[model samples]
Target: MKTKLNVGCGTDIKPDYINLDVADLPGVDVAHDLTKFPWPFADNSFDTIELINVLEHLPDTIATLEELHRIARPDAKVMVRVPYWNSPDMLADPTHLRSFSERTLNFFDPAFPECKDRPYYSTARFNIMRKSCYIRFFYYLKINARFLTTPLFFLARYLGAVVWVIEFDLRAAKSDNK
Candidate 1:
């Protein structure tokens, strides 16, 4: 059976997957603080993990990814969705400690130039499979057409607040157990 983890799942529960949240919400399997080190799970415990709208709330960017790495099985898929830096959601939510851009996750990819230049910065590694930025309006409209992504990204860069959410589909690239 394929084991899956829904990290920081706030009321959005999934059947058959381990639902985790900070609070004792309905259907939550693990109600633990994500900020704490050494999450309550064995190493390489999950085949897939999802952190929807959760990464930005964590304080330490590198540490959060590292913890995610620690629990992920090799080639595990991790889906992360965060508010774009230019989005009003980035500033609207006082709980959001950080925001993201198209290249924000590149630092964790060893194949990327930023990581290749200086790898000592982090121990965790992941291959970016797919990434997309969405406009706040289009996101609400649930229109995620690939053709619109590039144009939206371009517009968001030149004109601020065009994109609201940035989604990353990452595959865990782990070697040594530790």
Candidate 2:
């Protein structure tokens, strides 16, 4: 039986997933503070993990990712969704600790050029299989007005939103080299 985790799941819970949260909420299967180190589960305990609108709130994202990498099996698929850096969703929320961009995850992949110079920043590595950006519906008209005149149009069309969110499907690159 494969383990599926919904980390930081609040009111939302799926049937089979272990709904983990800091609060002892109604649907939570495991109530533990994610900010704490060495989560209860053993290493390589999970095959799939989802972080839906949860990463930005973490105080230490890199540490959290490292912990996730510690728990996930090699080639495990990890899904992450975060508000785009330029989006109002990222700014309006006082609890939001960080913003993300297309290149944010690239820092985790040592194969990426950005990490080539400073590989020691993170020992964990993941291969980003897919990423998508969504645009804010209300800002469509305003953004469209500048479509051909500025780069924002091209960025908006391909990247997504005045209140954009980005989703990434990452495969943990765990190996004996670690």
Q: Which candidate wins on TM-score? A: 1
lDDT of 1 at 73: 93
**Model 2 Cα lDDT, one tens digit per residue, 43-83:** 88888999999999999989999999998888888999898
Clashes of each: 0, 2
Model 1: per-residue lDDT, tens digit, 1-178?
4489999999999997999899999999989999998889989999899999999999998998999999999999999989888888898999999889888889999889988987998989999998887665544665453557777887888887788888999999987565
**Clash pairs of candidate 1?**
none
What is the lDDT of every predicted structure here?
A: 0.87, 0.80
- Model 2 residue runs over 4 Å out of place are 139-163, 176-178
